[model samples]
Target: MGRKHTPFTSLSRRKRRAKTLHIKNLIYRERDRLGGIFFDECDQVAALASGRWTWSDIIFLSQDPAIFWNAEIITANVAFADAVEDIAFNEAFSKLNAAETQQEMHLDFTPDVSSNGKRWLRKPALKYPQFDGLTFNDFIDKRALEIARDNPPAIYCGYRILPGYASGIGLQIVVEADRLNRAVIETAIADFRARGERNWISDVPARVCYSDKTICTPLKIKE
Candidate 1:
């Protein structure tokens, strides 16, 4: 059996144990550093990246919302006892493990060779940006998304792992957005998981579940 799954909310009786999402050092480039309250956390990031100069740039960038999200890498790992608690798991998780879905419950992370996952697959590692003036937050914002998409080289971030106790699996999704929202992020994660390779991403078996209790999962999303 895979790891026990609890909701990603606070620890609850229904969800005995669930793992939380984590990030190594997510970055936010100005843009009202305090505005991204929707994010899972602001711990890995430093506070100095905001204030006067930061705010100015964010305002300037806002003029063009196309690239608002630069980069952000949230780390994650599979824990058999508490795998289902992750934000990514719960987002599409509930849908993936539906009681009356036409698909199989034990789905594979690896998709066929024609899938995007296969097109952009690589070993686990981060892709740091080389921009001269861009701040750390900017790098995480910009390059992280590029890497997540895997334009050329593939990246295996912690977020892309299954909710199980096993090893040899993981995924990294880079996106643009100073603050990554859990609800939206989870939605995107689920989307990414749906049409990709079965072997490259995380692997685990989960069934639909719902309860009135808070899940025992952390708020953070990356390593």
Candidate 2:
């Protein structure tokens, strides 16, 4: 008989765990220096060559919109955990609170393949003059719709294993927005588990937020 499977031993889960660990380790290294937000706008190649910057230094740029327009925007399917995201935000908030002038801080951090995580899938850079009058959520909604239209429905799983620290698992069901109702998500999860990948399924459907006020999840739909 084939070997019985467990969560940790599963190839996919192990890979996800490795990614989560890497991101956590990066943040932990900068834990002390994380009390402030930082921004950078200089010659990218030259700055990286100077060895004065690192990817962790500017990871927060993922949250900013203006930088997307003025500079190159890189998107990564980062193994996101609440703790990791929270620590980064908390550090930045601390700096913002202590400053007499309320503005974002600037910094230079370079990333190389050495620091690359499984989530960082590089693609062609996208340049936008501005978001126009659309809010960030609006932009994301449009993009999500475009993606749904371009691709067929697919299910992807994500998880974070922190060993003795913390662990999380999530399942993303990608389908048309109209087709993403709670019933559909539940059925997808059921079907997924019926296929013997039940060990990788989260107790609740992964909360996929299309906008601040709108989110889809197994617990309850938020509007």
Candidate 3:
């Protein structure tokens, strides 16, 4: 025989349903917040890729602790680093080939005359490969190259959190795929909140890289 339904049982069921709905709503809210952060990070990467800013400019902007703590932001930071490295590598490859031929690459800079005509205002040259019809600076910034070479931006592998506040936490924020889905959103939200709650303190901000094995250190922000 089946058991009879009771008012108490109905009430308990309603409460369970209500609690589940609340948690679902909370997850959705967190997802939206994380989605926003992810897009903002992508925008920063786009700006750098489009030549709106230099590697130095991006590095300087990323130094803020607020930017570094989040998983989404770290993922974007890794993307930006990869983009810069690719750019530098391509430029070097092209130059090496061009150098072998000993082709004289012309400087594309057009000197603008000063108001008094006493001096010329030289605009910063674009750091890109020379094209057949286009021109580029003949000289390369050795210092910039050195910085890029030595401190190749690390990939966001994973993170580590110790028991005490003094030990601090290490996070390697990485998003393997380009596409964002529910799982990615949930993970991002969790990591972000975890880092925030921990309040990791340090003299220098932790440097994240693409590789899991790399020893996290502070990046040299200044060029």
Candidate 4:
């Protein structure tokens, strides 16, 4: 499985294009890299913020084992105030840390990602990746650690690991170890149907077995 790059109309600047996907400030117990939190509120920056956050602030969460994080991605309007945790899952990542683990994931806040490692968001990205497509009641049975053996698209976080060496603690994307193939196809269809974008798909080349069908994958992350 290898990548077949999808060429697009080159952009003059790579700014975050306007997104129709709503956002929210996911909220959950900061469980030492276990999962995410309740990222939905009215007074977002002021409600669940530990320090100062902004309407455009893109926060990062480091889950221990760097994988198997059970978090929620709430889709809100523009800011945390309008963000809504539309989906939640406890699964593996797809690309970033293809084959790695950490016991204690950490969380940091920074404005610049000068050193860590990352690229811009490319084509054929996942549209609405869910845990089990359970719709709040779908309990995950990742009892099987499966992942897509394909390399998905990625995006830069605009900041890097403050400590420098992000071995197991770097940026990543989460992909289910069990349903990667379908995931790939889903991505293509979504992009075309919703956004009128056509991109390529592949099984990928960066996946490593984490054991028992478990794949520590991410959503097109980098080191």
Candidate 1 structure quality by residue, lDDT tens digits, 70-144: 122332211211233232223333433244232433332444467855654432222223334553334434443
Candidate 3 segments whose C-alpha is farther than 4 A from its true place: 1-111, 117-120, 123-156, 160-170, 179-183, 189-223
* C-alpha RMSD between model 1 and the true structure: 22.2
The numbered model that scores best in lDDT is: 3
Worst-scoring 10-residue span by lDDT in model 1: 52-61
Clashes per candidate, residues 3 or more apart or on different chains: 33, 5, 6, 53
Clash pairs (backbone) in predicted model 2: 39-106, 39-107, 53-110, 54-109, 54-110
lDDT digits (tens) for residues 96-205 of candidate 2: 33331132243323344565743444333232224344433344445454443453223234222222212223222232222222233334334444554332434433
List per-candidate RMSD values in Å: 22.2, 22.5, 19.7, 24.7
Instruction: For residues 12-37, write the lDDT of model 4, one tens digit per residue.
Output: 12311111011112323322232232
Name the regions of candidate 4 deviating beyond 4 angstroms: 1-27, 30-157, 164-223
lDDT-sorted candidate list, best first:
3, 2, 1, 4
- TM-score of candidate 3 relative to the true fold: 0.26
Give the alpha-carbon lDDT of every model: 0.30, 0.31, 0.37, 0.24
Q: Pick the candidate with the highest TM-score.
A: 3
- lDDT value for model 3: 0.37
> Predicted candidate 2: what Cα RMSD to the true structure?
22.5
| Weakest ten-residue segment in model 4 by summed lDDT | 15-24
